[model samples]
Target: MKSAFIILLAALPFAAAAQTTQAELLRRGELTGTRPSARSQARQTAPRPANTASDPVQQHLLQTDVNLAQASADQLPSLYERFIATTRDERRQWTYPQWDAAGQVLARLNQRYEQVRTTLPLEERLRVRSFQGEFHTLRGARQVKDKLD
Candidate 1:
């Protein structure tokens, strides 16, 4: 049981990366570069959010300046589906701000999942767990991609 659990946990990030790698986001952007626009650049340069959050999850969200907390308990499955759809098939023509905005929406979706985790149906919760990991993985990958190039 322990080994199986360990293997599943180890593969989660890989699975997430497989769905949407950092390189993929950069390659799909129209500007041919990962540079932020003037407005996003200003937001990035602005003073960081306060670090007073006791929860690690809240702290991470603050650090990214992308709050994607979802408010609707009944919307998790559909929202995740929409996210997956947008990212997979429709975002190829997007620019930097669109990418950034998508990232923010992704963040909110994850937060909404967190908000309703306990209240969700078993199948919905399970489905969201998969999406939540993918979003975090994508966010981490994108943040690294931005920093590197």
Candidate 2:
């Protein structure tokens, strides 16, 4: 009876280890799997972009700027209106960071417009002023939303 009790105690650890799955052992750092391949190691070590431009809002704004730059005077109003509409729609879905990024872009765009205002035709300048006004309005709404949050 004493020998049987000693044997049971000795077998307990083996029983627990046998119940542990291979994945569980790996997760606990008690086992090692195959080494990562060269391709995987290279991917892990690769340098990332300084500005990944991962934000969709920033990407859209860049494309919008390109479109605005190429637009003719006759197309300016329609382009501006489309931009305003898209911005309004996207504003509702934006996170705080996204909204802040948009605000920065709008502010920069307004500044650029102001700097070149004298070079632009009067009609074009007026259109840019309208865009700046819309940007301010959106910014005001964002501020109010931020306060509520």
Candidate 3:
């Protein structure tokens, strides 16, 4: 009975540290006491705020940005659609500076979207994500095209 008790006590540490390796265990210190916090484990850093209206380059201020800023939660999808259509149709003619301007405008619009995202329907949220993905793809393609040229 004493031998079994000793075996279990020894096994307890191994069980608790099944995921960790020898090097990690040595570096992180003894896991016998308190575990390290999630905050100390390097969570994703927050994004820095963009300078929209105050941008030094004086970005292309689309009328959609004004409308989107004033829009209610339910109106966002339609406003996004308007912005997407305008950008999609116009992007073929854009230079690097124009693309940069469009990106700044999109960033400003995204800030507005974040404010009311939770209030939107699941379908609208998915649609917005889809729009964002498409815009990123379009922007990447433009960069590639520029590099080729």
In every candidate, how many clashes are there?
4, 0, 0
Error of 3 at 12 (Å): 49
Q: Residue-wise lDDT of candidate 3 within 1-149, one digit each (tens)?
A: 99999967766544543344534432332121123355423321445444334443232334333444455788767766765777788889888787667665665566566667888888998887677657666776666555445
State the C-alpha lDDT per candidate.
0.52, 0.52, 0.58
Q: Supply the global lDDT for candidate 3.
A: 0.58
TM-score of each: 0.41, 0.44, 0.56
- Screening candidate 3 with a backbone cut-off below 3 angstroms (N, C-alpha, C), the clashing residue pairs are none
Model 1: per-residue Cα lDDT over 48-92, one tens digit each? 543233434333323333233434577557667656655655444
Q: Tell me the tens digit of each residue's lDDT in model 2 across 33-133.
A: 22434653564367633333344554476544343323345444444455566677777777778756765555434323433445667777677557646
Q: What is the C-alpha RMSD of each candidate to the true structure, in Å?
A: 15.1, 23.8, 18.2
What would the C-alpha RMSD of candidate 1 be, to one decimal place?
A: 15.1
